[model samples]
Structure formats: C-alpha cells, structure tokens
Target: MEVGSTRSWDELLPDALGLIFKNLPLQELLTVVPTVCKSWGKAVMGPYCWQEIDIEEWSNRSEPGSVERMLRMLIARSNGSIHKLCVSGLQNEPVFSLIAENARSLRILCLPQSNMSDSIVEKIAGSLSMITFLDLSYCYKISARSLEAIGKNCKLLEGLRRNMHPLIMEERLSQDNEEAHAIATTMPNLKRLETAYLRYINTIGALEIIHSCPQLEYLDLRGCWQVKLDGEYLKDKFPKLKVLGPYVVDRYERNNDYEDWSDFSDSLYDYESSDDENRFGELEFRFYQQFNEDATNGWPPSP
Candidate 1:
C-alpha cells in the first residue's frame, strides 16, 4: 500500500474485470481480451461476463451455424445466469430450448428477424416467466397464438415490440385482428407496446388494446393503415398515453386511400413527442434495417 507501489492488471478480481469487459464489443471479448493473459481469459470465460449477452452485431456478420455455435458457447459460459439476451439469425429449435432451460434469470429477450414459430415460442414461454421485455419484430412466422402464450406465461412483461413491415394490399385485406385481440385479452399489465407498420390491425383491434391495457403509457401504431384513431377521444380517455401514428382521418375522398395513406409524411404527425419516441425510433430503425438485410441476403439457408 505504498504510494509508489504498483499492481498488475492480472491481480484484478474477476468481478472487477467482468464489469470492465462488459462494455467491450462481443467480437473483442471473444477474440482479443481472452488472448491477453491467462487471468483475463479466465475472467472472460466466467459467468460474470456473460450475464447480459448481445450478439446481434456479431451474428449479423457471421454465417448461420457460426452464430449458433457462438451462442451455445456463450450460454454455457453464463451457467444459467443470463439476464438479457438479444440476438438475430436464430434458425432452429434446440437453441431456443437450450436458452429456456439454462437462462432462468433472463428478463429481456430480443430476437428480431429470426425464424421463430408459434410452437417453439409456446413451448418456451412457460420457462421465460421472468422476462419483462421481449422484441419479436419482423419475425414473420410468429402469430397470435405465440403472443397469447407469452402473455399468459410472462406475467411480468412490461414492454413488447412486434413491429412488422407493411403487408401488400391483397394480404392486408384478408389479414385478421387476432394478434391484437390476443395481446389485449392476455397482457393487461403491459405498459409499452410497439406495433409499428402492422397493416392488418384495424380500429376495433386498436380500441380493444387501449381499453383493456389500462396501464399502457406508450403505444406506437405508426404505419398501421387500418387504424382510424379518434385523436381527441384517445387523448381524453388516456391522458398519459403517448401515441405515434396517423390518427387523423382525411376528409377528402380518394380511390386509393389505403394504398397511398400509409406513407410516412410530415402531415401525418399527430402524437406528442417524448423521450420514449426517440428510444422507440432507434429500435424501429434497427429492426427495419435488419429485416431488409435478411430479406435481401436470405439468411439461415435451408437445413
């Protein structure tokens, strides 16, 4: 403890090193830090550094099997203590099952643009009872059944992002409101719900969600062309609600309203801006970009 005395970096405790390493990118943690020294390697390989795993960036740049391998390795390192897991490019059921079995403490799960289906989600929802935040945006395979299962099981869920790209005109006309109804019926405790660009959710479904979820403070229905929101009514009913969408119905008649109206324009801005808008905006941009990339690149090739 002399003023001139020095300490080696390797002498630092694993807990302290884990805290420092958590800020580094996943690629660096996997490739660079462990190679520095034996003590650093041990620290990086421990559960402390793997508690909140975010491999989205790494997974996006890697091949399908590579992502799965890395996820399995990291999950093993976490040793049943992963708290927040956000990844993309998930292609199979075994990885999902492994997460449900191992990450008992996981609270936040984001798997945007993955190939997750109803059965897999239904099977895993029971084990993810502790999850508070879930993002399944642009996951085309998920439907109302999965939402219902998640709602019944993850009782503590506070935030959900189920954004999707706008469906074509033919598909939108035949699409049902089952997903919105499922959310309203089961997730009464939800405080934040983002369904941006979901083209099928009509006025009835939107009203059902608003009336059922009394605690909802943030709702993003942007690009939902079917929803015709009475802005005055919504403002009076839920004074605290912050909505982002085209709520005002146009008085002018047009033959192709549905086709042209959903486009984002300065005139469509009706909601009050807040900090949550910025946060949700970032998430929307990230997921939308990822969705486009996945579509163009065709990820998770046939097994």
Candidate 2:
C-alpha cells in the first residue's frame, strides 16, 4: 500500500550523502554536488568534503584571479583542515602565497608544471613544517635553491618527485648538480625520489643522492640520458635501496638534425599550452555527465 510513496533527495541523511560526495574529485564536490538542493548544499559546504584539493585536471582552464577566488572559497569551506593539494599551470605568485598562508596542515603537495619558483618553494617550507610528500615534476623554474630550502626546512619530507623540467634538460649535465648537492647536503630523511627525464643529471648526481639521502628506499632515474650506471657499484653503494634504470637507447643512434630538434621543441611547447586558452564551464558539465556511466563500469571515461 505504501509502494507509491516518494521521498525527495533532500530527505537523505547528510552523512550518507557525504560518503558519496567524498568519493568524487574536489572539483566535482565544489562545482556540481553542492548545486543539487538546499539540504545537499549545506552538507557539502562543510570542511570534511574539502580536505584534498587537486586541480591538475582543471589547471588548463584556471586563470590567476579565478584560482585565487576559488581557493579562497574552498579554504573558507575547509576551515584550515586541508592536508593534500595538487595544482598545475596557474603561475601567479600571490595565489601560491595564499595557499601557504592558509593550508598549514598540508602534508602532500603536488605542483607539477605550475611554474613555481625557488623563492616560492622557500616560502612553502617556511610556512608548512609538516609537509611529508612533494611533487615538483615539470616545474622548470625550480632549481637546487628550492631543494635547499625544502631540505633545510621540511625535515619530515619522505617522498619527492622532480621529473622533467623543460629548461634544465637543455642545459649541460655539470651545470645543474645543485639539486643533487642540495639533497645530499640537507634532506637526510628522504626515502623516495623520482628524477625522470632530467637529461643532464649524470652518475655523479645519482651517486650524491644515493650517498646523501640515507633513508632512500625508492629511486626512479628513468630518462636520465646522461647517467652511466655500474651494477656492482650501485649494489655496493646502496644495498638497501631499490633503483629504476635510466632510459636506454644507443647514443650513436640519436638524430642530430638541428631543424628537426627545433621543430620538435616547437610542437612540444605548443601542445603543452594549447588548453590554457580555454575555459572550464563546459568541461565541468561533461565531466559530471560522464561520471555515472564510468562509475557503474568501474573505469575512467575516455580522454
């Protein structure tokens, strides 16, 4: 007899609804889930739903001002409890400073391709003393100075990734040993490190990290074209550490055509920034629509 009775979505328990929202990415929580109704709107407005703020997917769409405003709103909603943050593409210093000012409890920070500088890294070190994991992959502006800042300040850091900086790869191997030296000199607590595609980094830098980072457990040297390795030396030097090998290709097989190199570089830079000029409104809607289909299938939507 009660089969036809209907309950509104607003009638659902807040805790139950929050569990569903928690599984969603941060962008979806802020832009989509809160828009459903007043009950859900209030539910998602809480700090628990904003603990991890990852904007790498939407980095292409964010402007300096937009990112600042978005962070302000999210930080207020988070109430200073943010622990993990990942952002890419947005390069404004003030916005980054704002993050350091608010998320004091951050533990895992990923800033791949974000155009962050050494000074900014120092500021982060100065602000958050508890950061344990950091990702600086493709952050071309960061150098050994930034590493020094982190090593000196963030004593708890256990994992670090500094893969593929575009500018550094073009320079000579000897010119950029600052990063290796800085790590050896400061971060004695580091356990995991990734240095993929750093073409200039050689055996000396690798050896420095191996000797300096006493707690090293994982090391990724893939695509480090200049690092020559001897199995026996590596085994003897780092008996407890596990290491991934560098990219393998015959050096003599390389193409040295100047015009070809220039063309490749131009194409690479163009593809990297092609999405920067676009907006996120339509993309957000599409992401939301695709979720249900992908969720049921237990797979991500096609890119």
Candidate 3:
C-alpha cells in the first residue's frame, strides 16, 4: 500500500471499489486502506461496503477510539446502508442509536462481549423486522422482559446468543422461569444457540432450550459449570448437536464418558459442501469459579 493524490468522486469508480471492499473486512479497510487517500476513502465509505460490516480485532491492536470513529464515519457516509452488523466489543448508546435509527434493513447482528441494556435490545429487535442472527455474549445485564420483545418481532430469527448472570436471590425467580420458557416457545426457527460461561444452570432451563429448538444443529454451552445433561437420555435429544457448553477453540478438551442412549449417526450434521468438506472436529468444555477483585487489579486463581 502506498500514498496517492486524492481524486473527486465524479471520477470515482464506485463499482470497482465496492467489489474490492467486498473482499476486505471492515476493521482492515477502516484503518488501513480508507486512510490512504480521499478517493479510496470515499469508495470505502460508500453504502455497499458499509451496509454489512464485520469488525474483528487481533491481539496486538491498540488506539482506543479508532473503531468507534470508523463506525461513526460509516454511519454518516453511508446514510444507513448498514444492515447486517457484526461487532466484538462494548459500544455506547450513540453508536447503537446510529444503527437503530436506520435499522429497518438490518438482518443479522453479532455483538458479542457487548455490555447492553434491555431497552436498547427491545428498540432494535422491535424495529428490525428482517433480523435473523442476534449474538449478545458477555452482556450480563440483559433481563427476560427485553427478551420477550425480541421473540415477538424477530420471528424469522434463525440464531440467538444470550448468556447472562442468573439472579439467585430475586423474588423474580418465577418470572425468570416463565420468561425462559416463553423464549423457547417463541423462537421456533432458531438453528444455533450460545451462551457465555455460566457457573451453574437449572436443568429446566437447559431442557427448555433443547426441546424448543428441535431443529438446533450447532450449540455452544461452554463455561456452563453447573448445567449437567443426562449423558444417557441426552443422546436422543442432542444427537444433532456438534458443539456443546462454551466456545474454546484453542485448547484441546477430552470428552467425558457418559451413558449413550441414542444413535449419533442419525442426527449429526454435515456442514460442508461436498467439494469443501475437510475438517471434522469436536470440542469439550471446561471452567472455574470465583476470581479476586484485587487491590491492584491482580487476577488470581492460577492453575
């Protein structure tokens, strides 16, 4: 990549640039290519590329407000071409408002590790009729009332990820139970479900998800320490599932021996096209409880 003189949009190749950007991820273009020159910047900020965004951050990146700045620019430049948004961090309300205000076209949204509120989720879910995938991992503050809104409007939804903390001492336990049950009943078309690392889970809650999403194929239940499935009976219910518990892709996990009651061959998925099928891998789950809020912010519980 090199520096070049800026050119006016009248001479811009919007179509060619769109094709180029279609292959580039959001994070890479916003930081590197878009900053190179005004011509490329205008092309990159065009509606076609900005409409559907995928932001991925690697381990060695810094510059606190860079992503925020880019997303804001895209929203302003594209005039709400953004429909399918995939984000990977905590975003404030201003950014959310940018998308929600022009959210009519949004279909799939991935906001893992977001610290979200119920009102915001309701607004987006209520407004976006075409939404299919909604991933909200590490957003521990979500409640059942907001989830109801999602089930109502996002009927065409195919995948949902909502893992938050369970309230043990609340008088709203009954409310929690019924709401959880309603989620299963409402989102019938969901094919993939995921949650964050939970120290424990009620068996009824677990059962509700399995029975509700009868067509479920990919399940990520990692970090759920207290939720145990009957290895024997689960064979019948979970035969189609491939991933279980939490998502741990780097480390190797050993599957625990459990009672086998169903035929695995009858339900296992074949995600690959005949020409592209190569890898067939299975992951196991693991977790721990409690961490210190240290005086100097030190993390404890070392293995």
Candidate 4:
C-alpha cells in the first residue's frame, strides 16, 4: 500500500510470496505485479492460485472490454480444475461461451447477468456433468427449452436458481396452454430451486417445476405473481423443501411501459434472508456495492 510495504514485499520468500500476492487486489494482482519480475510473474500465474475465478463485480462500465477479456484469463487459469465462479452483469457473448465450454470442471456456476440461451446451456450441461450449484437470476431471455436442456443434462445438479426480469422476457413465454410436465421430467436432481419474475407463466409451469424438482430443500418464488400458490400444494409436492419464500414486488413495469410507472427503492437484497447470516461474502458485497442501484426501466417484476 505504501513505499515501505512495497520494499517489504520485495523481501518475501516463495512461501510468503503468495500471501503478498493474495493481499493485493484482483486487478492489481493480475496486472501490475507481473511487470515487476519474471519470478513474480511465474509465481503469480500458477494453477493453485487460479483454481477459482470470481468476477463478482462489473461496476467499472467504462472498460467493459477489460472485464470481458478476463474470461480468457479465467478459462486459461482454470485448466480443468475450476470449482466455482460468480460472474454478474456481463454483456459479452464470448465470455458466456468460454465459461460454458472450458469450465467443464466446475462444480458451481453463478452467472446472474449472462444473456445466454438454451444452446449455450446445453453445451454447459453436456460438458460439465459434475455441476451441482447453478444460478442464472436476472437473465430473462432464457426459455423453458433451455430449462429443459439444463434438467436433462445436469444429472448431479443439487441447487438451481433461474430468475428473470419478467418484463424483459415477457415476449419469450406467453402461453398459458403449454405443457409443463415435459420440462419437469428433465430436471429431477434439484435439491434447491429459486425462481422469480414469473408473471407470464401459469400454474402448469409452476406445477411442472415443483413436481419435477422434488429434491428441493429450499424453494424461493419471490415475485411469482401469475402462479396460484398454496401451502397445501407445496407441502404435498415438495415434502423435503424446508424453506419456501414466494413474493410479489409492489412496483412493476409491464410491456416496456415505464412512462407512467413510479420507481421503487432498489435493494441488493431480494425477498428476505433465507440463510442464518447474510448470504453475501465480503468481496461480493464490495462488488455489488459499487453499482447495483440503477433504475431498471425494462426490468420485469417476475418471469
């Protein structure tokens, strides 16, 4: 942090080097220090230190390219050992592709803001069969076809969250007549399920998700406005589901019409806390704190 700290860092041994490197910020650790020397470069760019990637922040919107390029670094560093990743609010398509393809070693993937599709999700399921935890909240474009692909392929899947901005993707799933059983039969391994922004969907889709993903110990339906919910149905269908939260957001924008809408206060926290303590980690909190409060005009209340 200072000239003296820099001098002390120069004197650290290989064992101590990782500590110093770990102490450095992610961007600085990956960028600035490598320029110092070959030893530092070789030491810093190893598989052990790069086993996991967490681009938990995309606040610096000015250099979106740099953030997208980090996906390359992450894929290369992962080298088939990457265990967990949480990339939120990304715009690049290649980043999504590389994440789905090269991260076959992943056990958990929490891409909250990726604008991905069923094809990419199919690729992920085909590649990363060992995956257990997956969250795709806020990605509204994803369809039931993609969900079908996810359920079919992720056999070991334990926990899943597939929330969306209901308004952003209202055009995707409008049918009140679609069969829900087909999608339900695909994902039978889910131990936890969280869905929101589901205004367009009917009880059939809700029943499909509930009946199919019976292993759920946790079920969250914050903003499932359209689905007819009842404790009896949930209790009968999801016997093991110990936690359930179904919510309705008071403020909403429909059909891209924000002209008459009054904005509600935004919170990084959605619904209520299901975990004993706050679910967010320190780095994750720091990340979200930077930029998560934009007035989302096109965002749907449920999907």
Among these predictions, the greatest TM-score belongs to 1
TM per prediction = 0.82, 0.72, 0.66, 0.68
Error of 3 at 243 (Å): 5.3
> Mind sharing the TM-score for model 2?
0.72
Instruction: List model 4 lDDT by residue over 52-82, tens digit each.
Output: 5666554234255666677677668657667
What C-alpha lDDT values do all the predictions have?
A: 0.76, 0.66, 0.56, 0.58
lDDT of 2 by residue, 20-133 (tens): 787887667878887888888887998766677766566546665676577678777777878877766657887778778875888887776676888888877788678888
* Residue 178 error, candidate 3, Å: 6.3
Worst 10 residues of 4 by lDDT: 253-262
- Residue 196 lDDT in candidate 3: 38
Top-scoring candidate (lDDT): 1
**Which pairs of residues collide in model 1?**
none
Tell me which of candidates 2 and 3 scores higher on lDDT. Answer: 2
Model 4 Cα RMSD, 1 decimal: 9.3
What does the lDDT read for residue 260 in candidate 2? 20
User: What's the TM for model 1?
Assistant: 0.82
- Candidate 3, superposed: residue stretches over 4 Å from native: 1-13, 25-42, 58-66, 163-179, 246-303
